[model samples]
Target: MKEKNANSQSDSGYQRSLTNAHIQLIALGGTIGTGLFLGVGNSIRRAGPSVLLIYLVVGIFLFFLMRALGELIVSDLSKHTYIDFIEKYLGKDVGFITGYLYWFCLITLAMAEMTALGIYFQYWFPHLPTWVPGLITVAVLLFINLLSARLFGNLEFAFAIIKIVTVLAFVVLIAFMLLQGKSTSYGPVSFANLTAHGGFFAKGGIGFLSGFQMVIFSFVGIELLGFTASEAQNPKVTIRKAINEVPVRIILFYVLAIIAILVVIPWDKVSTNSSPFVQTLGATGLHNAGSIINFVVISAAISSTNSVLYSAGRLLFSITFNEKGKWNQTFGHLRRQLPQNSLILSAFMIEFAPLIIIIIGNDAFNFISSTTTSMFLIIWCIMLLSHVAYRKKTPEEELTDFKMPGFPVLDYLTLLFFIAMIVLLLFLPENRIAMIAALAVFVILAIFARIWRKEKTE
Candidate 1:
């Protein structure tokens, strides 16, 4: 049997077109999405100002997670995606299972974003159907993705700039308000708001724990930088820099922004029904603040959908590359040096967003989005385990400089942290069903993988 070269490109034609700037912005754009723009209010309402701590804790673990992944990518830049590393280190069946599971979750995530896009559009155009905006947005994004990887990077770059500017401007404006001793309908803009309501853990320990599910969801796409390595201009420099900046991005974008909102609106008064960004801006008497924030939120959703589609397409192509069968041949090959077929199939799957919305109504978006957090927790655990395996198999001298800090100890600790979060999700009543459903999907995939292995052997 021939040894599979971990550094060999699985497919022939992916262009190394994503520059450092593109990779940086893509990392920024992936971490800041509708979850932060629209869903933070729910987290705040659940955990109070302690949500700050929740964000910080989750951010730290995720930074460690990225370090493990960075080490893997730096060790083998020629591999198309992290899935390749999984296959190499953790058997072919596990790789097959993880790849398809990841692709499925991404498609569902894109659908949720599409559903949110429709709702955001309804804010301005009340008469439009909920699905129309989502359908149109998916169509346009699919077109952009099909054009080329560079074009996709360019669009994400533009979208990320809009998000970063909005967040920075909000934080700065809130700081000025605090310094000026500003007053709003709720109360004065003061740091006291953070603790005055109920001493930080306003909702008690349960609320703080409950906040993890959503906050963890907010960071779902952070690993997207791993997917970009195959197409990135220089994997070592660009990937390492992007991963190293995870902590800074989390603090600046999530922690500071949430702190600003809490200072302006007491934890008890923060509306869980809508974006705190829109609420904070509106309270400040900014003319058309709601409209402007709405536009930004819409762009955030589109940015998420675009990035997920790009990942889904590549993942599908990677998993199916060089496999036997008509389906594999069709999706595995690149057209015009791009994964056009795989991309089209992924986009087409997202078109079901409208039908899902029509069938399940508004709950569809929350249900789909919630399920992804549970699914990703499982995937992250597997990736961490794969990292452990890689370390055990490779001699120390063969390892790259971009190694995971604390080596074997921190690696196991990170794995345990993720496992604890998974257990927490199962205990939460609202998320229990979603978590169980995700587990069922994993089991089903494992069963299929077994059959697939048997067939391959035969």
Candidate 2:
């Protein structure tokens, strides 16, 4: 009944081809992850129940940041990609950096996501070697992204639906348990748990702020909106619709989810290494809830990797297509309605990166988690910095319709939170290495970017 933007159309007449369902899942698939499911305990340990405060702080910053990006996206219909916004508002050099950096983030995280999928799989299929299952998991995502965008969208939609349903089920179970007075053997779980153990601010100022390291990672995929701009069926309405809902989702999914968990489980014994969803559900005496949640997490991991694989390819293709960039057209070739070469390379990076860890006999899951903290933070900082430049350069009227509510203030606030998260990483031994590794990678990329630019100039 709906005539949507067709991928078969050339860029000359290209429009947002993605349906509303695709857009919804694109955001949810990337946002709701094994990280939230499994990692809340580490967060609780990091800041006690104060982790909910961290979620609130970060959530506010992201809301404005997305609004800024949304304003830029809607300013001009032709400016589809985030790169396009940065390019117009910033410059081509900055554009290339955003493109390559965004692609790299996807590649790095995809590696981690694949490794996580294998780890989650082993929870049930213990007899299997990590590499075999990991490789297969990577393959499944690869095939899906290589398929038509609609196919990829359908798969992602289904996967995100499963995640949403699981979380909704958790909320329902929590309400049911509370309503029925399913008292815990240790104690009747209630709001008292928020402070009974150590109080909400038990971590005090530094610990509360530093706890952001884990908290920030949970919000990494919030920018999934920027990636989908080019494909969104109705950019203005869709972009606004997505931005309007983010604040609510962050509260319900992240903030409220934290409160629900802490209410059910005691603070001191929480384990971030496993899905808080699993333990929370299992505590409610729901049979096989843990295994079922693990299954959903594996699917979520695969879905995230798949969507990001496509996004990475698109970014690389954009970089190569621009004459100002160093890469050649062959790498950017658009064929059969897909950036085939870019897709192939993106898939290769995602799959191959993990294979190295598997071959080296590292813990596949830990290796993936290593990139979880720092990589996304690096991208988030760069985006905010880029936005800082963007606001000064672009005409005020262009951004007037959807401009950030508290310019300058919110911009700086988001920056502060991002840095706070980085600082929080130093307090976290578990994720410290990931943070260090991301910085080292950034240094390497910066050096190469200079060389690439020099070569292009020559």
Candidate 3:
């Protein structure tokens, strides 16, 4: 299938120890996280049952986006990350900006997960300090990550399994409850709950539109499959498999799970302050159901933080690889074949989440999450543009078998979807500040890129 060193080891010193199973679960781990567990409540509060439509729309576009990325990864497997493809096809300037921006994106996302960790812990230990759980989590995850790539993959494998089983069980329980016509405090568990509450568009068009910000945030780490390309055992097969399953993952993990929650609790009744999963389970009057789901959501948040930290570390290493300067030299190189320094630095950055909590208090998670959603939307737009440039520049005969479906058209559509979402964020009163801040970061990075280029030339 026109392979070009598709299984070759990366020159960047990453070990290809992650097998097909690891890759699959890591993809699952990335898709289902604090965004789904905790953030879904926010989305439900905003859009009601219409949030399902939002998830479907975003999922379809992202699947196409991953196909474009899979083609790039298989086309030249030796590249360390998607940023390398960006640098090659879109020019070093764009690469420089995107690399740092993506690193910041992952870091911000990690912070959001950490913030969620505090909230999750509060369900059990209301009197404990909010920052205590996140601090301990970052410390433990950092050590595991610094050990080796395979170890990180193994940990994610276990975390993903926990999440999958819990979600599936929840869905099945809800279905059984519906079939029996069981009644909760709210009402009978039935699909009718989806439509009975405000006729599905209870919040109207603006509310539906508002859900996109957090729903998009929930899908932020989906591209983590791209970062694992270098470390995956068989890049072409594993990455393609992972990317191809995006639709299924979206349906199972997001669509069905959210449906279960809505059918049981009604969208308007779902708690915006905590995980709706816990709330739904509690409504069933199952003993310890609330506590059990709370534990699962905590695990979900930790799993997300772990995955993002892994990506953040690799992103930092990729961005600084072989660059000049003391900081670059410190974080750019791997130790014992692991990106130890880079991971440490990324973990260090995550420690700021607690400090952010101190400053913004309860608003920290939403603020950090909104900022990440804005940044990632911009990053996704750039990645799609790079994919388009790659196709135009490369000869038809040289392309891989995994080309993006409906080339150029679907690509442009995907780009438009993301850009429109960005515009939506800009207009939303709550997200407007974060959107503008993201744009400011982009402009600042562009200026630095110009100056860096000029300095190199002189």
Best candidate, lDDT-wise?
3
Candidate 1 lDDT score relative to the true structure: 0.88
lDDT of each: 0.88, 0.71, 0.91
Residue pairs in steric clash, candidate 2? 37-275, 38-274, 38-275, 42-272
Candidate 1 runs further than 4 Å off: 1-11
Q: Which one is best on TM-score?
A: 3
lDDT score, residue 415, model 1?
93
lDDT of each residue in 1-458, candidate 3, tens digit only: 33324344566887777888999999977888999999999999999999999999999999999999889888987788899999999999999999999999999999999999999888888887788899999999999998888899899999999999999999898888888989897888889988997889989999999999999998998888888887876778888888888999999999999999998898888987788998888888989999999988998999999999999999889988999999889989989788899899899999999999999999999999999999999999999998999999999999999999999999999999999998999999999999999999999999999999999889
Candidate 2 Cα misplacement greater than 4 A, ranges: 1-16, 184-187, 203-206, 324-327, 356-367, 370-372, 423-433
Q: Give the Cα-based TM-score of candidate 2 against the true structure.
A: 0.90
For 1-458, candidate 1 gives per-residue lDDT tens digits of: 12223233333468777778999999887888978986788788989999999999999999999999999988987788888899999999999999999998898888878887887787789778789998988899999998988899999999999999999999999999999999877779999999898899999999999999888888887898898877776667888998998999999999999999988889888765457788888888878988898899899999999999999999999998989989999999899778899999999999999998899886776777789899999999999999999999999899989999998888899899999998999999978999999999999999999997998899
* Rank list by TM-score: 3, 1, 2
Tell me the RMSD of model 2 versus the true structure: 3.2
Between candidates 2 and 3, the lDDT winner: 3
